[model samples]
Target: MSDTISLVVAGGGTAGHISPMLAIADAVKDEIPGAEITAIGSPGGLETKLVPEAGYRLELIPKAPMPRSINLDLFKFPLRFIKAVNGAKRVLKESNAQALLGVGGYVCTPAYIAAKKLGVPIFVHEANSKAGMANKVGAKTAVAVGTTFANTGLPGEEQVGMPMRSNVAQMDRAALREEARAFFGVSDQNPLLLVTGGSSGAQSINTAVAQSLGLLADAGVNVVHITGRGKQIMDASGQLLAHERYHQVEYVDRMEYAYAAADLMICRSGAGTVCELEVAGTPSVLVPLPIGNGEQKLNARELVAAGGAVLVDDKAFTKDYIAGHVAPLLADQHKLEEMSRAAAALGRRDAAQNMARKIIAEISSRSTSGQEG
Candidate 1:
C-alpha cells in the first residue's frame, strides 16, 4: 500500500446516508494517514452543509431521483442521469480515486456507474434490512457488499453493521450518565426518557408525548424531548410549557449527551437512530414512520426481535398507549436493565473500523492486480 490513498465516497440526502459515509471516511483516515477523501452529493441536499462541515471537500452533481410514476420527469431522466454520471466521472478522474465506496442514496447511482465505466473497484454498504433502490443497483456489480442487518437479500452481502460516529462508538454510557443528566437539568437518580423523531420531527410522536407529559412526569421519569426544528409543542392555551422534569427543546446539538442520559428512548426508527440506540445500549420504544416503502418498519424488526426494543405502529402511538405501555415500563427497572443488556450485546462497537479495513483491503487488492497486469 502507498503512503496515501484516494477514495470517493458517494451518499447523501439525509443524515442516515451522510452520517455513515462520514464515519467510514473518518475510519479510513485513522487507518491510513494522509488519505485523500472526497464526498459526492446532490447540489442542494443536506450533504452540501454537513459534508463540508465535517471537513471534507464536497463535489456536487445534479440529482436524478427515480420518478415513481409516468410523468414528464421520467422522459427527461436519461439526460439528467447521463449528466450526473459524466459529472461523477470527472470527479473520479480529477481526484484519481482508487475505489468508490457508496453508502446508498440518489447520488450513489451515478457514482457507481462512473466507477464501472472507469474500471475502478466499487464497494457498497446498505444500512437498512431491505436494500434501497440505489444500493440494489450498485450491488449487482459491486466488488463487495456490506449490510447493517443480516439476510438483506443482496448477493454476497456481509453483515458488517452500521458505521457510527467515534463518540457514539466509544461512548461509556454509565460513566457519563451523571454529567449528562445534569447537563439536561434532570436528576441523576431518575430514569430518563429521550423522545425524538429525527431532524424533521414526526407530528404523531410530538402530539402523543406533549399530551402525556404530565403522566410521564408523575411516573418519576425525566423527559428530554427534542421536538425537531420548527415543530411546536403547546398546552391548551397554545403556550409552550416548561416543566421541571419535562424538558422540551427544538433540537439537540450534541446527541451523545442525550444518549448518555437516556435510560429509554421513544422515537421513530430510522436506520441511523436504531443503530445509534443499540450501540449506545439505550432501550427504546420505536414508532416507525408510516411512509416511504415501509423502510423504517423493516429497520426496527431485528432490534424488536432481539428484545432490545419494542415496536408500535404510528397510529397506535397515542397518549393512551404511552400511558398504558410506556408508563409501566418506566416503573420496571429490572425490565429496562434486561433490554439494555440485549441492545448492548447486539451492538458491533467496531463497525467503522471493520468497514474501513474491508475497503482498504479491496483497494490493496485492486492495486496489486493493476501492477501485475
Candidate 2:
C-alpha cells in the first residue's frame, strides 16, 4: 500500500449528517498523514459552509431530493439525479479517490452510485436507527456498513456507534463542571438544566420550557435554554420573577461548556444530540419530534431503553408536564446519578477512530489486491 490514501466523504443538509462526516474525516487525516480527503455536498446544503470551515475541500453536486408523491419534481428527478451522479464522478476522477465513505444524505446517493460505477470501494455509516433512503440503497453494494444503533436492518450492518467530536466524546463533566457552570453564570450548589432544540430550535420545546421557567426557578434549578437562531422566548407569566435563574439564548457556540454545566438535559432526540449526551454521561428528558418518519423516536429508543433518559410525548411536553414529571426528576439526586451511569455505559468513546480504521483497511485491502493482480 502507498503511504497515503485518497477518500471522498458524502453527507450534508443537516448538522446530524455533517458532524459525523467531519469527525471521521478528522480521524482519517490523523491516522494517515498526507491523506487526501474531499467532501461532496449539494451547493445549497449546510456542508457548503461547514465543510470549508472545518478545513476540507468541498465539491458541489445538484440537490436531487427523492420525491415520495407523483408530481412534476418526480418526473424531473431522473435528469437531476443523473447530473448529480456525473458531478460526483467528475470529483472522484479529479481527486483519484480510492474509496468513498457515505454518512447518509442527499449527497450520499449520487456519490455512492458514482463510486460504484467507477469501481471505487464504498463504505456506509448510518447515524440514525432508522436508515435514511440514501444509506439504505448504498448499503446493498457497499463493502461494509456501520450504524449508530444495532439492528438497523440495513445490509451488512455493524454497530459502530455515532462518530462524535473528539472533545465532546472525551469530555469529563466533573473536571470542567465548575468552570462551565460559572461561564453560564450558574451557581455551584444549584442543579443545572440545559434545554436545546438544535440549530433552528423546535417551537414545541421552546414554548414548553419558556412556560415552565418560573416553576423550574421555584424548584431552585438553574436553566440554560438555547432557543436557536432568531428564536425569542419570553417567560409565560405576566411578571418575570427570579429571572436570574432562567437564562435564555439564541444559540450556544461552545456546547462542550453547556454539556459540562448541565446536570440534566431537556432536548429533542436527534441522533447527534443523543450520542453527545451519552458520551458526556448526561441524563436527559428526550422529547422526540412528532413528525416525519418517526426517526427521532427511533434515535431515542436505545438510550431510553437503557434507563439513561426519560421519553415524553411531544404533545404532553408542556408546563404541566414539567411541573409533574421533570420537577421531581430534578429533585432526585440519586436517580440522576444512576441515569448518568447508564448513559456513560452506553457511550462509545472511540467511534470516529473505529470507523476511520475500517475505511483505511478497506482501501488498503483493495490496493493490495490490485497490485497482486
Candidate 3:
C-alpha cells in the first residue's frame, strides 16, 4: 500500500475555528511530507476566504444553523442539512479522504455524517471547555477527540492543547519584539497597548478603546489597535497619527508583530486568541465575549486560574475599568515581565506538531486497512 494519507477537515465559521484548522493542516503536511488535506466550509463564511488564502483547498458546503432552542428558523434546518450532507459526501468521495476531523460548528455536522456513512474514521477537535452541539453529536462515533481545554466531554479525549500557526509558533520572541516595534514605528522608550476585539472586532471593546484614546495616549501608551474592517466605532476617538504614537488598523495581517510590539493586550477571550497570547508570552487583560453560554469566559478562567491572564467582565469594560485594569499593569514593568513569563510558560508550543502527527497516524492506519482489503 502507498504511504500517502488523505484527510478532510470540516468546520469553520469564525477565526476561532478556521485558524486552528489551518494550523493542523499545516502540521499534517509538515509531519507526513505528502499528506493531502481538504477543508470543508460554508461559501460565505470566513473559512471560504481564509482557507484558500492559507493555501489549502476548500470544499464549500451548503449549511444553516440549527437553533439550540425553539426558533422560527428551525423549520428550515432539515432541508438545509440534507443539502449540506450531500455536498459533504461529494467532496469526501472526490478527494478520496480516509478520515474527517470535525472542528465543531453547524457546518461540521454534514461532513461528520458523510464520513460516518462512508465508514471513514472520524476525529474531533473541540476548542472550547464546553462542547458545541456539533461535536457533542459526533462524539458517540468519533474514534478520538482532541481538546484545547482539559475537560471537554468526549469518551476517549486527549488534551492536545491548541495549535498555533507555524509562523506564530516558530517565532523568536526577542527578535520579534524588535521587529514588531519597528513595524508599528514605536521605539523601546514608549510602551505599546495592543487592543483587538476578535477578528471582526467587538463593538463594546472598539467603542471603549476609541473613547479612551486620549487617556491611552496621555498615559504614554502608543496604541496598536486592530479595529476590524467596516466596524462603525473603529475611529470614534480620533484619527490615527502615524509616527507619533497611535497605530490603528482595520485588521492585523502580521500577528507576530502585534504580539512582539505590545506591552499589554486588552482583548476578547476566544480559544485561539488566548493560545496565541500564551504562545507569544504576551500578557493580556481578557474580556470574555458576553454572548452565548459563557464559553469564552470559561476559557479565560483557565488562563486566570494558571495566573497567566487577568479577566475583566464584559459589563465592567468601560474606559475607567480599561484604564484601571490595563494602565496599572503597563505602568509596572515588573508585573508585566512576570505575567509575560507565566503566559509563555502556559503555552504548549509543540501542540501543532503533536496533533498533526496523531491525525496522520490515524489516516495512515485507515489507508493501510483499505489497501489490504
Candidate 4:
C-alpha cells in the first residue's frame, strides 16, 4: 500500500454529480499539494468527458443501469453488480486510495460495496434535499455522510452543503458582470436573461422560451439560451434579433461567465445551478425538473422561502405564463436587487473547502491509527 493521500470519487449520471466530484478534487489538491484524485464512471456517462477535461485521471468502470421494467436485463444485475465491485476493488488497490467517496448514483454501488468489504473508510456526499436510492443504500455504511440539505434522512449525516466550483466561491458581482457581458458580447442597456436546464438542456423550457422569444425581445430583454444539442430551437424569430443581443449555445464551458452576464436567470432548479446562483448573487425564476421523486422541487423550496426565486410548476410553464412572470421582473430594478441580495445570502460558498477539511482530518486520523495506504 502506498502512503500517498489518494481518493477515488465514484459515481456519475449528470453534471450535478460529476461537477461536485471535480470540486472536491480541486479542494483536496488546494489543501494537500500531494493529494491525488481519480474518478470512476461508466463508459458513456457525462463523467467520461467531464472528469478528464477537469484535469483528473478517470478510470472507466463497467456498471449497468437498473432497468425500470421486468426485462431479461434484470438477470444481469447480479453478475454486473459483482463485476462492478471487483472492478472497484482493482481501482482501490491500484491507486492506493485511502478512502472511497461515493457521490451518489448507480455507479456508486461498486466503490461503496468494495470499501465495506475491504474495511476502508467510505464518505458520501448527497447533493439533493432528499436522498437518492444509491445514497440511501450507501448511507448505512458511510463513515461520514455530507449533504446539501439539513434534514437528510440518513442518521449521522452532516449537512455539509453542496460542493461548488472555485469560481463560484470567488465570484464578485461588479467585476464578474463587466467581464461576462464583454465575454458574451452583450450590451449593458438590454436586460440579459440567462436560460439553461443543466448540461443536457431542458426541452420544455427551451420550447416555451422559443415560443416567447418575440415577447421577450419586445420587452427589451436580451436572451442567452443554452439549449442542449438534441433539443433544437433555432428559428426565424430568435435569428431575427441582432446577433449581439442574443446568444444561443448547446453547452456553456464557463458557467461563471454566463451567470455574470445575466440580469436575471430562468432555469431548472438543479442543485449545482441553484448553488451557483446563490454564489453569483443572481436572481432566478426556477422551473424545477419534474423527475426523481420531486428532488428539484425540494431544492427550489428553500430558495423560494428565502425570497431568492420564484418557483413555477412545470405544468404552468406555458409561453404566455413565462412571459407574463418574467416581463415585470426584467422591468423592475428594485425587485431584482432584493432577489439578488437574497440569493447571495442563501449560497454556501465554502462548501467545497469545508468538505475537504473534514475529509483530510478523517484520513489523517485513520492514518495515525495505522490504517495508512
| Candidate number with greatest TM-score | 1
> What TM-score, over all chains together, does every model reach?
0.97, 0.96, 0.92, 0.93
What total of clashing residue pairs does each candidate reach?
0, 0, 0, 1
Best by lDDT: 2
**Model 1 ranges off by over 4 Å:** 236-238, 371-373
In the range 1-373, model 3's lDDT, one tens digit per residue, is: 2446788998888888877788888888877767778999997788989988988899889877777787777887889889999999999999888888888887888888888998888888888888888888787798878888888777788888887787888877777887788887677667889999866888888778777778777878888878778763423356443334677777878898888888889899989888888888888989898989989988887677777789988888899986787777788899888888989888877777777777777766766776889
Q: Write the per-residue lDDT of candidate 2 for residues 20-126, one digit (tens) a residue.
A: 99999999998997899999999788998899999999999999988989999999999999999999999999999998999998999999999999999898999
**Local accuracy of candidate 4 as per-residue lDDT tens digits, 136-229:** 8788988888898778697678887789888777888768787788877676667899888877888888888877877887888888988876
Q: How many angstroms is residue 191 displaced in model 3 relative to the true structure, after the best TM-score fit?
A: 1.4
lDDT, model 1, position 140: 89
Model 1 lDDT, residue 44, Cα: 82
- lDDT of all the models against the reference? 0.90, 0.90, 0.82, 0.83
Candidate 2 clashing pairs? none
Lowest-lDDT window of 10 residues in candidate 2?
233-242
Better of 2 and 4 by TM-score: 2
